[model samples]
Target: MSVKIILAGGGTGGHIFPAIAIANAIKKQQPDAEILFVGAKGRMEMEKVPQAGYEIKGIDIIGFNRSSLIKNIGLPFKLLRSFVQVRTIINQFKPDAVIGVGGYSSFPVLRFAQSKGIASFIHESNSFAGKANMMLGKKATKVFVASDGMEKFFPAQKIMITGNPVRASISLSSITKEEGLKYFGLETTKKTVLVVGGSLGAKSINEAIDAGLEEFEKNNLQLIWQTGKIYAEKAKTRAEGKFNVWVNEFISQMEHAYSAADVVISRAGAMAIAEICLVAKPAVFVPYPHAAEDHQTVNAKHLVEKHAGLMVKDNEAKEKLVSSIIALAKDEAKQNELKQHIAKLGVSDADTVIATEVLKLIKK
Candidate 1:
């Protein structure tokens, strides 16, 4: 009989992309697998999941507003309504297994699945676990993690250090640097810096880069900048008539950006780190200060401790980021050292490993 699986969770690209990678891996192994995605209504996944060519169901759910208590007055109603929606989805889908990839939407689906004795799995991509995932871990059949020491968050016996799944376009990219530069309408002779601040963009990073555009030009460095939506117009205005820079709200083909880059500036989100490590580029990270449990800093610190990457605090980016990138650009030896060290941490087949294990256990 064909197997059916439900992959749940997604608010950001970090969660959505990994879920898509896992779905693709499952399809590769089980051609007849009927896969479905579940995400919070109106969230990015509702759109991104379909773009990935998978069917998805969205629950009327939203996470609690930590910054503004008044914004959460309707939280209980939404949660209750989402559980009802989840029950209908579970009853109809009757999935063999449910996988949660760390988003508020996943909680209801996985909880209902576990309550029904359906095997449920979780993929926690952060060094510090989210509260929802921690609660879900107790009953989870398996918890896949990106790094070691996750036993403190999940049940020791139930954890697997499978690493975060990188999007295949990045992990398996064969695009040459010259071709990548040409794709971005940039010159191969100039060193290129790729700046990415996640799907929503990073305000501090954007402001810093904007302030340092002339400095980058002065150093003869080119840039391929993904400004996300909010900063797109301002970035375009800043880059006007500048042949050395390419600016876009989003770079749909990030493989090209990775190939073209001599150095990278990025937020330390799990998927971003995984992709950067896979690409083996020298990077300087600006971890978002407000991430839950300050996890982004923890992620960057782990690499910095191993000499795998450099970091600048978000608040310090405007003052220190440009100088750091310029310094690293001039130091080829440091670049190579970082490249070699970070490359060692990349896992190219995490999607396959997680998919195979989930399928194998369910079949038994």
Candidate 2:
């Protein structure tokens, strides 16, 4: 019999992309499997999941408003409504298993699945676990994690350290630096720096890069900048007529960007870190200060402690980011050292491993 599965969760690319990777891996192993995604209504996953060629159902849900208590007045009603929607989805789909990849929507779907005694799994990409995942972990059949020592968050017996599943386009990329530069209409001779601040973009990183555009030019460094939607117009205006820079709201083909870059500046989101590690590029991370439990900082610090990468705090990015990146770009020895160390941390087959395990357990 063909297996049916529901992959739930995703507010950001960090969650959505990994879920897609896992879904793809599952399809590769079980060609006849039917997969569906459950995400929060109007969230990025509602749009991104379909783009990845998977069907999805959206629940009316929102996370707590940490910055404002007034904004959370409707929280209970939303959660209650989402559980109702999840019940409808699960009853209609009758999935053989459910997987939560860490987002607000994942909670209702996974919680409902566990209540029904359907096989349920979770992928917690961060060292620091989310509150929803922690609660779900108790009843989860399995909990896949990016690193070791996750027993503190999930049941020790349920934890599996498979590492974060990096998008195949990156982990398996064969694009040459020259080919990548040509894709961006940049010169192969100039050193290139790739700047990415997640799918929503980073205001501090954007401001710093904007302020230091001339400095980058002075140092003969070029850039392939993914400004996200929020800063796209401002970045374009700042980069106008600059042959050394290519600025866009998003880079659909990030493999090219990774290949072209000699140095990288990025937010320390789990998926971003995984991709960067796979690409083995020298990177300077600026962790988003407001991430839940400040996990982004923990992610960056883990690498920095091992000398695999460098970091600048979010508030310091405007003053220190450009100079740090420029110095790293110019230092081939330092770059190579970082590349070697960081490459050691990359896991190329995590998707396959997670998929195989999920299928194996569910079949039993």
Worst 10 contiguous positions by lDDT, candidate 1: 58-67
lDDT of each: 0.95, 0.95
lDDT of 2 at 267: 97
- lDDT of model 1 at residue 53? 97
Show where candidate 2 strays beyond 4 Å: none
Q: After superposition, how far is residue 41 of candidate 1 from its true place, in Å?
A: 1.5
- lDDT by residue (tens digit), candidate 1, 50-89: 9999999999998987789999999999999999999999
**Candidate 1, TM-score vs. the true structure?**
0.99
Give TM-scores for every candidate, taking all chains together and pairing residue i with residue i. 0.99, 0.99
Following a full C-alpha superposition, what root-mean-square deviation does model 2 have from the true structure?
A: 0.8
